[model samples]
Target: MEHTQDNGSVVYPDVKTDYHGHPNYFRVLIYLLVLLGLSLAVFEFNLPANVAIAIVFAVAVWKIGMVIRNFMHLRYEPILIWIAVFAAVFILLAFFWGVFPDVSMVHRELAPKL
Candidate 1:
């Protein structure tokens, strides 16, 4: 048996649903805007190359996490779903690492002449 809320989300019997009353979309938008502004500022600032790149990358990761958690609603998902998502990322990183050396040698003397 299930009961439906006004928001249309069904409440199942014995199932744990930690509904946080739905996130505020406007607040998430504001957060995204701030993160975007910070990322853009990294390009405008005269910081050192390594520092600027690191900051921009960090901002990008932060933005991705925020989007995933809030926009994609991943924060409300079960632990298994999170594990699957992380596993996919791990596979992608493994693939990238496996191919990275060959890609880096593309313009070097070790590269085969075609």
Candidate 2:
């Protein structure tokens, strides 16, 4: 294949090539397996309510990281981007931490009245 370049020249072999020069079938299979494992974690584990919530949240976070790094192609993004993401995650976690106790207390108080 040939393509016109910015300098008005024809460049041969213009199509982008894979980094490894081959299809990554194994990687795709592994990603599918990981998703299956996450699904199984949700249904297979019989845990206490609080512990189940924590486990599901942790698995969701891990799956999100995998999607961001692999599917979104952000694995090689700049360190600044990683720092920003981490900062956002930390702030959100802090917010959740601050709100959870108050919410739990409110629910507990309401439980007895109902």
Candidate 3:
């Protein structure tokens, strides 16, 4: 809801904004703490390297989302902004995909037996 002032400027009353307004800081802090704790737990288990990497990557993705939503105020943004962000992510993934096979193949074929 908005109210119009005598100067013809509009003021939003009930709408909550994140960046320039009050943010849900407590929730964000809780998420950060939880993710941090989980990351620190990575050394406790004797899981295989691949599984450990996957777990850490999952947590990292979640933490990134939380930071984007709360810290960057991306949750309140429009759909086009989301599309743009996703496009950037896709481009990054494509770059990594292009680089992965060469690295992996070289590592697999050229590794010296220990």
Candidate 4:
């Protein structure tokens, strides 16, 4: 009896093509620059609190999208998958909004009593 490996290809094959190519140094440098700029904006800027928070969140979302599309290989996924991803994001935002008011009211009420 002989054991078979996954992919069912022979244990040793000659002249196999590499699935992954070499990294592009230029593209990686550009990504690094963008990340550094975003980091600087978050930590060094003297913007209003809400504005800073919004900027950070926006940059984070952009970075996440980049990673999902490139690193996760989701760029070619179906539209349904994109819709599901966006729907989950909206649901999370709604959940936070629903809880924020109650939390704010509780803090306000408790602050006055204390």
Model 3, span 1-114: residue lDDT tens: 554544567667655542233356887899799998997799689889899889999999999999888778787677999999999999999999999888788866576765
Q: Tens-digit lDDT track for model 1 on 2-43? A: 645446887665546444334667888899899989988886
* Better by TM-score, candidate 3 or 1: 1
How good is model 2 by TM-score?
Answer: 0.54
Which 10 consecutive positions of candidate 2 have the poorest summed lDDT?
Answer: 14-23
Tens digit of per-residue lDDT, candidate 4, span 1-114: 122333454333232442222234457458857975885668577888888888888777777776677565456456898899889999999999999888877756566564
Least accurate stretch of 10 residues (summed lDDT) in model 3? 14-23
> Any residue pairs clashing in model 4, and if so which?
none
Per residue, candidate 2 scores C-alpha lDDT tens digits across 5-104 of 4356665652465221122446745875787587567656777778877777787677777767766546645689889989998999999999888777
Measured over all alpha carbons after superposition, the RMSD of each candidate to the real structure, in angstroms, is 5.5, 8.6, 7.2, 9.4
Model 2 misplaced regions, further than 4 Å? 1-29, 45-54, 110-114
Best by lDDT: 1
**Alpha-carbon runs more than 4 Å astray in model 1:** 1-21, 102-107
Q: Which candidate is the best by TM-score?
A: 1
| List of clashing residue pairs for candidate 3 | none
Q: Can you rank all candidates by lDDT, best first?
A: 1, 3, 2, 4
In terms of TM-score, how similar is model 4 to the real structure?
0.57
Query: How accurate locally is residue 15 in candidate 2, as Cα lDDT from 0 to 100?
Result: 48
lDDT of each: 0.82, 0.66, 0.79, 0.65
